[model samples]
Target chain A: MIGRLNHVGIATPSIEGAIAVYRDLLGATVIREPFDLPAQGVRVCFIDTPNSQIELIEPLGEASPVHAFLKKFPQGGQHHVCFEVPDIHAAAADMAAKGATVLGQPRIGAHGTPVIFVHPKSMGGVLVELMETPKGDHH
Target chain B: MIGRLNHVGIATPSIEGAIAVYRDLLGATVIREPFDLPAQGVRVCFIDTPNSQIELIEPLGEASPVHAFLKKFPQGGQHHVCFEVPDIHAAAADMAAKGATVLGQPRIGAHGTPVIFVHPKSMGGVLVELMETPKGDHH
Candidate 1:
């Protein structure tokens, strides 16, 4: 059901510092400017790769999950791996039926596409994000 | 210069248990049989997706890096994200020149491709793996 590896989310204490690694070191030329998503409680930016993207996420508030991750690791780390699914609703349903814990209802993700998170416990302790590929961008 | 996301490595205590989740829960039909990579000090298997894969890694011995990860988290978690680079040597040199710690030297990775790892400290604490794509598989 997974289409492509959409983006790998990295929880960072400082997005600017992480951006430097991708920009100055990796020579990534198409990094989108970072933006805050209050609803998601994080600030995010996309570092485009040849086939996918690296998502840098920083906590926007104390209540943010990224905040807790930062508190635990201080330096931050890989937070989640997102994969594109052709249909979010069906993916979630399939996961639920097969005993995977779907976090919540499908909601608009950072890419403006419906997405749902699978509980880490059910996915070998790696948080898995299932996103419906935006129309016309399907692979 | 990343080519594509080859795989997201997930450290797991039990490969069998993780395989069930990918097979029964996600309905992945192209799961590769688990194999032990004694050189890498881990047992691994590829769960193929449309565009990439989920590499399930389990510690093979006390010296395994996955052993350390499991000790810290117990439940296991995302180990590292591997991105394909057209030239692993150049990628390592480029990262080193930019002050990123390229761990050790490029060695044969699970996919039989030359791969190098970047230290997490220089990458916002997210361990990044850069691998040269196998010939004839360029994207």
Candidate 2:
């Protein structure tokens, strides 16, 4: 079951610029600096919002999943909604049992958080991401 | 200043279908039922998450904002992020002073909640919505 709304992912052309806007204009504080996740071929930055955080995603390579997204929707925009779960594997298995297609096997995401993506086809054409915060990572 | 992320807005083809996916499959419960906002030309349903809610938006008319988005993207996807603010008018003025273009004057949104949107171009091309919860409407 979902524990919380972890973060909302926004795909942007430049993480630095996004960070600046959220920080300076919107009064959001930078929670984390840009970090590269080579496996996902993307660089990410987090901005602290009131109740949750805003994740800025910038594709690092041509093969990044976001690359295709950018091509189809040139306008950078909201990308995904990630829900916090107690156990990623169990949540994914439950979803699979309910006829949802799991996009990838559970794997370590940014900052060693266990994450899995649910296919858009099974969720009314909206991509959903589920993440389980590692033990002792609570802020 | 923003307090926390209130919700993430997702544009979907069918609000009913999205409700099933978020509730039955993803373990999100429906804290709010479908509500129509004629001014915005969309119907919305909210799925409760611990930190925030996932707002599913369905365009009601051809001229609806989500309608145009769907026409261009075809695939339903994340639409916008709403940040909770203590004062809607103050937040809008502050954002405008910081060079962000306000979509329109702050107006009552679904459930009579005051809300305003900032232009995507001014916010790193990601549409950002600001909302102020009425004192008596806190959930």
Candidate 3:
């Protein structure tokens, strides 16, 4: 079962520009500096809220999927929503059994935890990511 | 200041179909039954997660904005992300001073609270809603 809404990923043309919107405009005070996730092919920044986070992501490589997404939505937009599940493998099996198309096998996600994506077609057109809750994180 | 992420709005063609995806497919147990928010021109259903809610919305009438969105995507998709604000009035002024366009004046949202939307163009193409945190409903 899904435990919590982990984070909402917002693809951005420039992480610095997005940071300004959240910090200066939205009055967000807990933004973390942008960091590169080489394996994920994206630059990441976190805007922490009281109960969740807004992840600002920018394409980092020639073949990064975010680049393709940016081509479709040139200005960048909400990319996907992630939910923490009890177990990634079991969640994949459950999704398959319930008729949703699992995009691929569980792999390390931006959070450094096993994660799998469900195709947007089978999910009402909203791309969804299922992540294995971090070992020590019960929430 | 923005508080919690109140909900992520997903525009769906069918509320019943979206309900099944969250309940049967995603193993969500706390799904709320669909209800009409005629003033907002949509039928709404809430999928409760520990940290936030996933709001499934379907166009309710001919003039609903969701109809325009559905015409574009057809299969439905993420529409907007809503964050709770301590004061909607002040938030609007803050956004104006910082160069983001407030879509319109704050009005009654689906949750029966004052809410305003920021133009997607000004926020990295992410449509954002800022709602006044309901009295005594602090997250």
Candidate 4:
């Protein structure tokens, strides 16, 4: 079952520009510096809030998945929402049983935890990432 | 300043279908039945997660803002992200000082709280709604 609302992903052309908006303008103070996740094909930054996080991601290369998204939305936009699940493999099975398409086998996500994506078609046009509840995470 | 993520507003053509995906398929257990919010020009349903809520919205009339979004997406999509701010008036002033466009004066939102929207042009092409934190609610 879905647990906490983990974070909302926003695909942007520049993480620094997105940081300016979220940090200086919106007053988000605790922010993580941009870091590249070659496997995820993104230069990612995290803006932490009281409850969840705002993930700002920029395409790291031409083959990055967000490359096409950035083309469609030049100024970038909300890309997906991630929720914590108790178990990754079980969640994948649940998705399959319910006729939802899991993007691939559970893989390590930016959080360093196992995660899988349910296609937007199955989630009603929302790309939903199911992240296994991190070890020691109470929520 | 932004506080908790109040909710993510998802525009959907059918609240029932969205509910089926969130509740039955995704195992989201606590769900509030759909209700009409005529002033907001949409019917709303809430899927409660441990931390935040997922708001599913369906345009109530042709004049509804989401009506235009549905035309472009047909299948609906993530419409906007709402965050709680400590003081609505101050937040609006801050947005103004930051050169962010506030759509209009703070008005009552679906949550019955004063909320104002920043144009997508300002929030990195993400429509952001700032709502006054509900009374006595601690994140």
Candidate 5:
């Protein structure tokens, strides 16, 4: 079962600028600095909201999925809503069973958690992400 | 000071359908049903997340600002992030003092709370909202 919302991902052209705006303008504290995830072709920084988090994502390469999202929707806005789950693989399977398109097999996300993306078509055009906490075996 | 993320507002084409999707598909419970806010030009339903809430907004009139936002950005998606504050007026004043554009004077919001919206331009194109629990006098 999907749990609480972990974070809202914001796709930006420049992570540095987005960070400054979130921190200075919105008074949000930076929970993590920019970190690269080569497999995902992006770098991420996390800003803490009182109850959740705001993930800032910047494409590391032209081939990145985030890069394509930006190219298609250049509004510099919300990218996805990630929900915490106990088992990403199970959640993805369940969603697929319910006629939702699973983006891919569960993989390690930037925070070392297993995660998968659900296509927006199943969610009324809002991209939904499911993430699982790292298990002892995976870590 | 902002305490935590209060909720994320999603502008949807259909409030009932959206509520059903969140409840049936995501296993979320409806904390509140559709409530009309004529002053805000919208009707909203609240679904509880583990830590926060997802507010589905359905605009009541074509002249509503949310309608304009939908017209400009046709994709039904996350609309704004609201932070819980101790004092809405003070927070709005502070934001305005920091060169951010305050959308309006703090007004009574849903659940009898005082709320104000910060302009998207001030927050890197992401709309930010500040909300305060109403004091006894205001309530």
Candidate 6:
């Protein structure tokens, strides 16, 4: 159902600090400037790699979904893994049929793509996000 | 200096159960048979996706590296992200020079490729593994 590893989301207390590691340390050339997604309640940025990208997410407010995660982890950690799917609707249905919990209806994700999150409890504790690949991109 | 995402390491208490999710739920066709690596103190299997892979790892003994992780998490979780690099030695030196703690010298990893791990503390709490790509495969 999944196509490719779109990006790996990493929760962090500070996006700037995370950027430094990927930019200065890892020598990543394509580090997008950080931006806020108030609706999602998180500040995000992408660091491009040879194959995929790393998404750094910081809690934007108390209501941020990542807030509780950061509270328990404090130091922050791997938040989730997003996989590209050819069809979000079909993927969601397939996963649901296989006894996975679709957290919510498909919503516009950070990539401006339709995405749905599967409850981590049903994914062996690994939070999983299935995203619809943008039109024209062949995986 | 990362080449491509070779695999995502998921620490699970039961590799068999994990395989079902990837194989049956996700419709993964290439699910490698589980094998024990006593030296690494773990049993491992690989589920290949279109772009990368999911490595299901289960602690083999009390001394397994993932033993403590499972004890703390209980439900199992994403343990680390492994990236392919062109040269393992150079990657290690570069990371070390940037203040990232290289866990130990490069050693043969699950894919029979040389690999080194960077401490989670230095990587925004995300344990990172750098593996040298197998000869002849371009990242």
- Listed per prediction, chain B TM-scores read 0.96, 0.92, 0.95, 0.96, 0.90, 0.95
Please tell me how candidate 1 rates in CAPRI terms: medium
lDDT of 2 by residue, B13-48 (tens): 888877877778877765587889888899998887
Q: Which prediction has more favorable TM-score, 2 or 3?
A: 3
Candidate 4 structure quality by residue, lDDT tens digits, A1-139? 9999999999999998999999888999999878899988889988998889999999999999999999999999999999999899999998999899899899998888999999999898999999998899765
lDDT by residue for model 3 (A53-125), tens = 9999999987888999999999999999999998999999999988889987889987789999999999999
> Which clashing pairs does model 2 show?
A50-B3, A50-B4, A51-B4, A51-B5
CA RMSD for every model? 1.6, 2.1, 1.2, 0.9, 3.4, 1.3
**Per-residue alpha-carbon lDDT of model 6 for B1-139, expressed as tens digits?**
7768888999999999999877787777888989997878999999887778889999999999999999988889999999888899999999998888999899989999899999988888999999999998854
The best-first sequence of candidates by TM-score reads 4, 3, 6, 1, 2, 5
Per-candidate Cα lDDT values, in order, are 0.88, 0.81, 0.91, 0.92, 0.79, 0.89
B40-90: candidate 3 lDDT, tens digit per residue: 799999999988999999999879989999999898999999999989999
Q: What is the TM-score of each candidate against the true structure?
A: 0.94, 0.91, 0.97, 0.98, 0.90, 0.96
Candidate 6: clashing pairs of residues: none
Q: In terms of DockQ, which candidate is strongest?
A: 4
- Point out the higher-scoring one by TM-score: 2 or 6: 6
RMSD over all Cα atoms, model 3: 1.2
CA deviation > 4 Å runs, candidate 2: A136-139, B136-139
lDDT (Cα, tens digit) per residue for candidate 2, span A1-139: 8877878788887787777787788887556878999999899988776567778899998999988878865657778778788888898889999999998799888758889998878877667888997688554
Candidate 4, residue A18: Cα displacement in angstroms equals: 0.3
Better of 3 and 6 by DockQ: 3
The clash count for each model shown is 0, 4, 0, 0, 1, 0
Question: What TM value does the first chain of each candidate achieve?
Answer: 0.96, 0.92, 0.93, 0.97, 0.91, 0.95
Worst 10 residues of 1 chain A by lDDT: A21-30
Summing lDDT over every window of 10 consecutive residues in candidate 5 chain B, give the lowest-scoring window. Answer: B130-139
What DockQ does candidate 6 score? 0.74
Model 5 has a DockQ score of: 0.55
RMSD of 2: 2.1
